[model samples]
Target: MASVARSLRKVFVGGLPWTVGTNELRQYFSEFGHVVNAFVIFDRNTGLSRGYGFVTFGNPAGFNSALNQQKHILEGNVLQIQPAN
Candidate 1:
């Protein structure tokens, strides 16, 4: 049998300071669910956050539910949540 790939979602989170790192991002995403992982995309040269990143939830149900209710003002920025590739 083929192993099933995990169901993960991505989010567009902007308005973070350049100092924000993966751990902080993961902690912020934890409010939605059990964050399997979180990372802020960065530029190769400047090594700065690209103003967005991905967040993966360990539980699919929790992830989808979060997509419906999670939004701006709480994080101080409007975040876009969507299915990952």
Candidate 2:
């Protein structure tokens, strides 16, 4: 459903807390702008968070907004954000 995973409008967020779920992730990122998609990766077998996720924005403005922010904190933990590979 995506043109490409490496677009500037997409970001890879690592260091997500176990408590951060898909909906929560979407909500947090909504501050920047309309979030096209957001979800936290999870371990398939254990059903726990894999401590990483991806976010796709509706526009590059949202992506740049998020990227320009100095820090991102969620669930009391700082997150590592980078452009999607």
Task: Give the winner by lDDT.
Answer: 2
Instruction: Record all residue pairs in model 1 with backbone atoms less than 3 Å apart, i.e. clashing.
Output: none
Q: What lDDT is obtained when candidate 2 is compared to the true structure?
A: 0.91
- Model 2 clash count equals 0
Alpha-carbon TM-score of each model against the true structure: 0.72, 0.92
User: How far off is model 2, as Cα RMSD?
Assistant: 2.0
Query: Model 1: per-residue lDDT, tens digit, 20-72?
Result: 78898888778777887778889999987887777777777657766787454
Candidate 2, 47: how far from true, in Å? 0.3
- Shift in Å, residue 69, candidate 1: 1.6
- State which candidate has the highest TM-score: 2
Clashes of each: 0, 0
lDDT of 2 at 82: 94
What lDDT score belongs to each candidate, Candidate 1 first? 0.68, 0.91
